[model samples]
Target: MLEKVTGLSDLKEILHDKEDEEIVFTNGCFDILHVGHVRYLQEAKAKGDLLVVGINSDESVRQLKGKKRPIVPEMERAEMLAALEMIDYVIIFTELTAKNIISELKPDIYVKGGDYKVNELPEAEVVAEYEGRIELVKEVRGASTTNIVAEISKRY
Candidate 1:
């Protein structure tokens, strides 16, 4: 079973004993788990001791990715992410952006794909405020939900 955390406070208590542990965080819609997502996560986890993923809720995904997005529900997405041995924790947030969660968790390193500019993301400011590191990983081409959806639509 995947361990569930309700809020930020619960998050602190869970890592209280391991303050020195490097916490790497990443957030995304994760509507459909694919090779790109997995590779990105693995790279992020390599830089820290713990990998915490902040998943946008189903509602939030729709707001960002449009109405037809999030082919999978938030719970299912979170559960799938948690199942990966490289992912240490998964938190689902109702917000479209992960700024709130980033501030709350204050992870040692915040990671995003190369698609985003380091200075442009909301999480970037949060990481800056705490003097945390922000890593822009190499993007995986043809590994986006947009392409995935298009492929499915072409088939059916």
Candidate 2:
């Protein structure tokens, strides 16, 4: 499972041989794993032969979610995602958005939670440039790390 966690260059090398497969790509901070994440990933995986997840690096997560965010560290987060049965590959990225990763990977399909609009995504252009399909998985209502954190805080 840990072996599933890899760097971009190495992932590219590995993916190079998988040209015959329909690659599915998705990215997020994944600060704290939850049921919503599991279902989202499973849905993403069903879109293609392989599911590659780009995780936000610790610094990137901080930039996006504020300093006290990312309840889990980057490596731990990557490992957690890699451990998932539906996830074929997991890579940590320092970018705030998935545009660079999407540009480089150019996956057959790009998946995101339905919470985001396709037109609002920065990586949507890159996906379109490569003629890749964009999929939006319906999010599980009331199932999010932010909500979990708030509930924990309120109880504590």
Candidate 3:
């Protein structure tokens, strides 16, 4: 259950054994898992040997997505991602940005959805410092948590 969810210290230890493996990292709120999220993660995994997802904590999500957001709890969201075969590990981060985690992990490839530009990503600088490349995955059209929530609200 919690096996795939790890803290920074434990993740660091695990990463030590993956020296020969290419690590791909991506961070997001992931409030509601959907086809878009699935496709994005699958594509991210294709770029490296292991895909490490940095999940924004509940507090961070509230700050970023608004107080009423994150209809799903952080732990549950992490569990859902961990259950996916495309995901290798899940790390919950408390900060608004994954800059610190990116700096520490120094993944071989840092991935983001097509909605973001490589140069526009704050983590891009950190990845650059480690000589890691940034890749933008194609987004699934008409799929987003906000839209999903709005549609749900309209129904009930």
* Candidate 2's TM-score: 0.98
How well is each residue in 9-116 modelled by candidate 3, as lDDT tens digits?
Answer: 999999999999999999899999999999999999999999999999999999999999788999999999999999999999999999999999999999999999
Residues 1-156, candidate 1: write the lDDT tens digits: 367534567777776767989999898988889999999999999989998888998999999988887899988998888889898888889997899988888899999998889979977877899999999898998898889889989999
Error of 2 at 98 (Å): 0.7
lDDT of 3: 0.94
Better of 1 and 3 by TM-score: 3
**Which runs of model 3 end up more than 4 angstroms from their true locations?**
none
Error of 2 at 111 (Å): 0.2
lDDT of 2 by residue, 33-147 (tens): 9999999999999999999999999999889889998899999999989989999999999989999999999999999999999999899999999899999999899999899
For model 1, name the residue pairs that clash.
none
What lDDT score belongs to each candidate, Candidate 1 first? 0.87, 0.94, 0.94
TM values, all candidates: 0.95, 0.98, 0.98
